[model samples]
Target: MSLTDNKSAGEELLLSRHSVRKYEPGVTIPEAELNEILELAASAPSSWNLQHWRFLVVTEQANKEKLLPIAYNQQQVVDASVVVIVLGDLQANEVAPKVYESATPQIRDMMLGQINGAYSNNPGLARDEAIRNGSLAAMQLMLAARAKGYDTVPMGGYNQAALIQELNIPDRYVPIMMLPIGKAQAPARATERLPLEDQVIRERF
Candidate 1:
């Protein structure tokens, strides 16, 4: 059944969540469906709309084979339907004049001045902030995938340096993580979660 057609309570996105490792062999996700999910991922908010996230969708079998070794030899690296490599550009925000120019005049002036102030105050801090912002977008993509009845695994076991070199990513770009997407061979069991009272804090501690 299509996720869109299922309006049943048991099919709620959150309730249907699971981390899939093994997937059915020879299954491929359609391009349109993949784009639809990515569109939702792109809708995730970012600082000043800079949208620092960059995704590399891996489908070529040869490329996947090369990545397998670098990804800690995880069989899933080559087994999944698709592997999306999430990247963060560390220098995009520092070069934001055109970004401001694309904005409405009022916002353009405001953002230009704000960006200047941010740069002057702490150049390095802004880059780190941008990386963190990109990470949030990556999380949004994973959630959107799960919501669409797709199984995913967020992996950081890969060698970042090797991936960056293999992907020919620019020096200012950093690989954040890899997300494997497809149907789950078996449903993932729920893991432990911290109790609300233990994790929550009131207005004043």
Candidate 2:
């Protein structure tokens, strides 16, 4: 397809995506198919390509029940096929070797030095990178699921401390958001957005 055609297709996909909160209960997405979606999500860009994100997939009914209370009794937790806990890795630089495994030793070492230096100099940068890069993967994850005929909604209402404890999340990672994906029980709610002219920014505001 031509570039314009590709752009139209992209717009179509964006338009078709909407947050779905009511999923059909007991509708399971096969692990293999879900993995395909996850693989695509992992391709999202990261600072220094350290890939500072980890997915906690909650698929068992018992686990979902345990999560429901922490999420304020949101029914989507139990009804959705899977609830993904997107975690940001605060120690992403530790994976520098793996991220640049294909590069020459000298190049890899230099990149690792840069990654480690920036993070160590400013301790808060690790947290910021984790959240920012993890969020990019999360958005791609949602889009990939949608392209495969699944519905999802991004939720941030859960109790963070309880989630970490319940899921046994390690200290090195921070919980980013909870995303529930499955077949929707009903069509998603139609939404509107501000016009481009009103929302876009110009140079120097």
Candidate 3:
């Protein structure tokens, strides 16, 4: 299917909302499609343009098997066409000088100053900022997958320590979420949400 469709913006947004747990058997997500979806995900905004999220796509059966137990034995981890392990680099600014150098000079110097200042004054804040940037990227990935007619489940419940060990993720990187993607087994039922009036507060709060 072509990425560009004639659907109105609102229609696209509404239709793109669904979480799929079950998937059809023996279907593999095309590598091209996966790449396109991730390309779109990278466009998500981040503080100081610091893209701190790293996605590890688990495709091999053996690697997936190693993750199954760590993921709470969720069948989706093993059965889905793709499993995206979202890792947040807590010290990307310090570790990747090239990432900053690639940025435009205006933003680059600004971010570098902020990074250096915070690292010296408040290390905790620097760590918090990195995780925040990474989370924004993860959300973009999920929404981009949805927009492309793919179904996904965002998994947060799992054994973090075991997953880190099994995946060989470094100490500076934290596994924040796992996303299993594939076609849905059945159409998703309508999800209940809080009323807009209750959920959105005006400026007065």
lDDT of 3 by residue, 2-114 (tens): 33578878567656667777876456889999998888888877665667788989877778777788878888787777889988877766754566777788988887887
Q: Which candidate model has the greater lDDT, 2 or 3? A: 2
Over 1-205, each residue of candidate 2 has an lDDT whose tens digit, in order, gives 7324656667877777899989999988999999999998899999998889899999999999999999999999999999999999999999998989999999998999998899889969999999999999999899999989998899999999999999999999999989999999998888877887899888866
Model 1 TM-score (2 dp)? 0.85
lDDT of 1 at 200: 92
Q: How many backbone clashes does candidate 1 have?
A: 0
lDDT top scorer = 2
TM-score for all models, in order of appearance: 0.85, 0.94, 0.85
Quick one: best TM-score, which candidate? 2
List candidate 2 stretches off by more than 4 Å: 1-7
lDDT of the candidates, in the order given? 0.79, 0.92, 0.78
| Candidate 1 segments whose C-alpha is farther than 4 A from its true place | 1-11, 94-99
Pairs of residues at least 3 apart in sequence or in different chains that clash in candidate 3 = none
> Sorted on lDDT, highest at the top, how do the candidates line up?
2, 1, 3
Q: How displaced is residue 37 in candidate 1, in Å?
A: 1.1
Candidates 2 and 3 compared by TM-score, better number: 2
